[model samples]
Target: MSSMSAPSLNFLAGGGEMGEIIRATDWSGSPLGTPETWPGSLRTLVQVMLMSGQPMFIAWGPERIMLYNDGYAPMCANRHPWALGKPFAEVWADIIDAVGPIMDAAYAGIPTYMDDIEFLMTRHGKQVETHFSFGYTPVHDHEDRVAGMFCTALEITSEVAEAKARKADAERLREMFEQAPSAIAVLRGRDYVFEVANSAYQRLVAKSDFLGRPAADVIPDLLEQGFSDLLDRVYETGEPFIGAGVPITVTDTETGTTIDYMMDFVYQPMRDADGEIDAIFVEVADATERHKAEKMQAILNEELAHRIKNQMAVVQAIVSQTLRNAADVRSARQLINGRLVALSSAHDLLVRGKGERASVRKLIETAMEPYGRGDGRQINLTGTEIEVGPKAALSLALILHELATNAVKYGALSVPEGHLDIAWGTSVDEESTTFDLTWTESGGPSVDEPSAPGFGTRLLRGGITGVESRVELDYSPGGFTFVLSTPLADIVIS
Candidate 1:
């Protein structure tokens, strides 16, 4: 690289370090012979490019010979001085796919401008992603033919990456809000215009006309309930408000019905970068179902307490009756124990917590259990399935206990040849549905009405105890028959 020192190169004198480098460069072996014979337009453009502080380059003649100023030297990394005399396309062969068309267009007398273009280039043995905003202008020759291109450019890789990061962050935030289970909403500005409302919030309000409208206008129920005032206070003070188990009543706009909600909610003020409140974030957790369940539990507790008191009264009556009717102390204990076991069987079904009801068939079987009687050989029971409430079930259990006791002592059950048959079925009349049960004793000694009624006889007559119930007794030479009729509604609990 020898100094030219020619007086004709004064145009190269004022371009700083690039001008000194160009002046000292040799041209004997170059395709373009010398500076003295080179095209004047190319020389003048090179002079202007060198003097400019901006990153600039020139690709002149058919070969696109490359020339660049000091400002563009660092952009080329280690390829600076060597890239000088090489073709621009060869110097940047790795990025030629992206820049080839622009270069062609500039040489065809057209200019191309781009605010941002990206390139992945091999820089100093490492792959680097870079962005640039540049313009390529056609440089005309002496005959006014497009023969070269001039470019001005600057790197903007960091700026583009920052903007992309912000977009990804915004998308993630939106997804988080939408997928959350709790109802979420955003109100912006002093008017409290709805900026966002997620799916849960839509279901809570049962409305969709919330966006771009003020809260007071779209959700009148909240406004009427003084919640609007509360929101305003929070926004003005930039403070957060939280409420737990707060009750709110709203009208169903479509159905015109009122619904109540119990909610645990929050109103959080959101601030901008400058610490000024710009919006309010709302979150609501519905608690209405929990409240209803608690209320039902309270009602059930009261029902159980009431049933306990009634059961105590029934036990006292059974105790007194057994003691009065017993012939001796041992018989009294046996009678009381049998009656209580029957009573316990009915109670076991009723107190199972499914509901206060017992199966009619199960109660009958239980009562006969104490007398060592079952339906297989000497006893037969046939009935349509029926369910009875606590009141009817208790009475039936006591009545059956008395009947079985009598049979075991002096009736059909007292003899091996005797047998008992109990059958029940339903009837429908104009007024209601009813049921009838018949207990018959057969194949025993001849029977007739007793001289006077005893506790057992009285219990049988009065035990099928609805006001509409009727009982009949028949004492025949062959058997004793007892029948009871009652309204079906008096027994069914569910």
Candidate 2:
């Protein structure tokens, strides 16, 4: 270790006057009257020395050290005045551990300096940690030999206590991070190497035994799946990356089957002391069961949509036929009962599918099967993943049945060579979802607009009323066209 430099030591009062004061006064001498006997210039010097901010002490005989001014005595103001003339140790034995080293250095003529030293000192029956900046310098005799030492110190107890409390709080945060519940990994750089992995992270990768490996090497599948790019982007730009509905393939050893997991994750950047991003904390949650449930719900929705349309078609046919074929009031009532029985069968299918929507393709095929071949090619269906709600499916079923019934009676399906082209597309128009479906007839007998709107038109228009949509039925000489417009949100895919 290197030696420390010597600090400056200029006494408040010079040697001659300080020596005189020491000789004129007893072992417990103070500056109260000694200044009156001295020269005016010396008296002025002693006054200034006594008034200095640093504590001052003088030794007049063996074992007696007197404190000369307000600076030194206030440090012990609570002590009895009769204790002042006694040896320094007798009055200050409570803090002798702190005073012994300073006194030894000064009396041996070796000056000492120490700053912010902490020690417990007894005051009013309580031990308080007293911080101090201290220096001890020996007084020289005429021949320059060591006589006694003087000590100077300042208290700084509060600062050290605050620093200690702050350190403890930081340590607690570190422990919490180490034991977090979620799968968390702190990564750094382009490779997103794991600088720290919590206990949950270890269990996730199934390698709790080797925690310090690079994240890329440990989880190669994650990098291959493009998760590394997200991690690097967050680390570089200091932005967070959040993702949901991400799938993970997990192999179960017991079942010998591949299990699919839906997961959500977040990658948040951690900045270092210089405000540069140095790490990223990755959090992942498994949502496999939730994803499976959503898929099942989509299938159920499609089924319900199919059943509701069929049920509405049966009701429309029953009401329209009963009104047309009744010979008298009693006969009409009997006919209504028989038609309602057919409607009841359709209602049974609707109840079986619960409240969710059903597949439009299946519903359309089912409605048209009675009129012509069930093969869907006869009715061109072109669209991407067109989903419909329960009410929309029921309404669409009625509309398709009405069109199919007309085609069998007087439109396309009545002829063996006739074909119905069904095409659908989605678009955003006027801040609403518009599903434009074009249904055209070809190779069929000539057709013209109905002389008057029939029960079919009324049922078609009323079926889609609950949902926001418009149905247009146009009849031309060659064939008929039905254009339907509806909100896209009403047909949202599950």
Candidate 3:
């Protein structure tokens, strides 16, 4: 028979729209007779049928006879079939007490459910936590009034345990992302809103609070730099985009200064379950400092090339002159070799300093080494310790070497009584410092200004000018004078 065609009990238990409770014994009629015909044999056969292959339990009213199918009975906490047909409260009082609220709701004509409730019960002498979702439904009488309650539930223990485990794994993944050593951020939607950011991202954009803000809003400069548009396209097309050497200008929040940065990153689109693009993930690696160092290195290389060419031309000119004035080929070869040796010594000093900045004192000492220390009484050196960087030192050393050579031939140092004075001092002006050095000669042959410029005179002036400096040569009656000034800031000490 269908469930609706089944006969109901005579007693009204609790549940219905209108509240009423009456016992079958008080009514003075057969328990299953009168208007409600509940046949015991038919009810037993029906209960057995409903219990087949299902977790179902039945509680009859008044007598409160409890019954369960074989499938449902095994899940009970230590109870037996012999205990069936007894009052539910009498046989399994503890289980019934714990489930009383659910039963009460069901008897009140309201279906009740408990989702993932933990039940700690002893099984094989060991207590284990079992999770289950239980539901209780009301059984009605002949008058369609609430009578007893039925329970149908299954153990969801394994599913609950797995869910908890997965939740913990997800938490660990989140921690890894948050504690990463480099910047990390998550963007969402086509607009690429900043859904989340790590500590490193906060450090870069100090003033902007990135969380919950759109990427473009926090970094307006990114829009102009094409990053915003690039992300939008990547999201729209569900494609990954990569960039390198992207120049960006960022404001230093503390110093309020503009700083340049070079960055490289990839925009990878994230998809939803349906495989439609929903967001973009940006992975950025900053290389600003490295790029700047590389550029500076390139500039230094160019300067070194220019200086080498200039030095070679000077040496060639000196060799040509010596050859012209030589009385014999041996004399010409000897003079060229001596001058080349002096030039090589000066270059050795420059190289030892690693091209950073050369020491002015070292530069002069190396260039003058070829000239016998000249009687100390003949050449007077009076100067504060002023440094010249590599570029400046190289230029100044060449000029000093040419002057020393000319002196050995025709100036003050050419004779025993001839005297030379060299002095240097530094002064600062605005953003630049000027290093002034004076070279003066006296007590030599009364020298007159040459009618034509010589290689020594031209090189002294040209070399200094090539290195962004100035030189003034005077043909003084007393002997000769040379004044040179170069910027002090370019002088590298280390």
Candidate 4:
């Protein structure tokens, strides 16, 4: 057991720092024994592994003793100088669970190759994600026995991480495009192939088969509407184009009906790294409803101006008639004030309504507010829901005010036990619908018919003539009653 004398290690010479460490290390008590008595195959493999510029390693014999080249030193991390003479399994104890099976496969001569394999390895006291592109080749010894596994490895962690980051970025961008509220689309090349169209863009076009299809093929209407020309200008000049409230019409594929749209949009040319425009990005907001509202506001402003003039005329007529018919100056002033208040109440009712028509219930309630004590005994009125046109509404309010004033001066409302009851109903026939409102008063002094056609008498008859309505008055010994009948269509303005 004296064995062969120590020998010159030419196979381990001039191999940089790793080779010196392996050469100087005492392997006398290990499973590998001294290097002088190493197998010829293991010696030759070690020599080849040492001379490599790439990272390479050899685990030899049944113990799988570790030996690696200078190129593999950085991969060893803090374990380099100490990892020189240990078994492969002990040296890579951190990743042995993952690399253990691959080693067995290579040692069994099946061989293993991988472009990328992942391992969470603790290196330099921190766990890091590691990737390797490596190959394991079976090393043979004397008499054709498998001696060990040789490995050539390179780390590719950064490359994998970068690729994953780019993929995640693309997915995030795709989600943003899909969920955008406004219409968004991307067109590529001169023929304008649709590469991306979001849900809003699909609805705006009234179509969904847009991906990879030419814009003209899908929507020739847009081409005829000169959108293609705009796109051409943008693409050719490499400049952005903006359209505000641009009218567009699209035909529905299912119904064959044309839908009109007003859109505020942009055709932004997308340029490449060479500064050449390759595609155009389209973003659009539908402004049809907004445009319609603006137009409606303009019309309302005009109507408001016209109504203001008409209201002044009506007020002037009321003032002139009140001053002419009053018996005294003080009486004329009171009459004018009362008539004006009634007119104001009518205007308030219409304003709370549609401004063109007023509700019958609101008109009566407002007219009677000054006289009613809120006890439900003075004024009892019940009626079907009806809308009166603005012109008729003003006259009706004044008529109600006059009737109440006359009652307070001479009729039922002059006494504590007096009460007024008015009821209205709709009578629908084949020809037309007529509105009938009946007013009756009781529990007061008797009333006599007027001797002449006074201002109040003329007002009651002619004030609501605009609606083709007729008013009737009855003077009975018990109480006075009044009734009004008019065509529903005449009083209700659409």
Candidate 3 yields a Cα-based lDDT of 0.67
* Collision pairs in model 3: 357-390, 358-389, 358-390, 389-491
lDDT of candidate 1 at residue 410, scale 0 to 100? 58
TM-scores for all predictions: 0.61, 0.43, 0.54, 0.67
Regions of model 3 farther than 4 Å from truth: 1-112, 119-129, 136-150, 205-210, 213-220, 250-259, 303-380, 384-494
Worst 10-residue lDDT window for candidate 2 reads: 1-10
Error of 1 at 82 (Å): 5.3
Candidate with more favorable, higher TM-score: 2 or 4:
4
Give the candidate order by descending lDDT: 4, 1, 3, 2
Q: Write the residue-wise lDDT of candidate 4 on 1-494 in tens digits.
A: 22223354677766788877787778899788888778888888888888888999888889888888888888888988788768989998999999999999988988999999999988989999988899999987766778888999988888999989999999999889899988999999998899999999999999997799998888899889999899999999988999999999999888999999999999999988998899999999999999999998996686566556545655665566566667999988887787678667755765554357777777787766544333577778888888888777766766776676577667886666888887888898899998888879999898999999665676677647467877789999899998888888887763
The parts of candidate 1 lying over 4 Å away from their true place are 2-55, 69-84, 94-97, 119-130, 141-147, 250-258, 297-360, 363-383, 386-494
Deviating ranges (above 4 Å) for candidate 2: 1-10, 13-159, 175-181, 188-193, 209-213, 249-260, 299-494
Q: Candidate 2 overall Cα lDDT vs. reference?
A: 0.63
For model 1, give the 10-residue run with minimal summed lDDT. Answer: 346-355
lDDT of 1 by residue, 1-494 (tens): 42447756656766677677777778766766577777888888887888899989888888888888888887787787788878888999999998998999999999999999999987898889988889999999879998788999877788899888999898888888889888999999888899999888888887886799998787899778979888989998988999988999877788988878999899999999999999999999898987888897896676456446545645665566567667999998988798778767655654452447777888788766544447468899999889888778867776776676566555787677889998888989899888788899998878879899855677688856554678998998898898988888876752
For lDDT, candidate 1 versus 4, the one ahead is: 4
Model 4 TM-score, all chains together? 0.67
Clashing pairs in 1: none
Writing each residue's lDDT as its tens digit, candidate 3 over 1-494 gives: 12323346422222221112122122234333332455444354334534356566666676555655555555665655444455666665545556666667777789987886776755545677877787777777767777776767777888999999999998887687678755667798866789877776666555546678877678776577777778778877778998887887877656878767788777888888999888777666677777889897996786566556556655665566677667999988887888779778877875664466555666776766555443468776767776656656666776786787667666886666789888888878878778888889988887787788755566677745435667788887789898887766644431
Per lDDT, the best of the predicted structures is 4
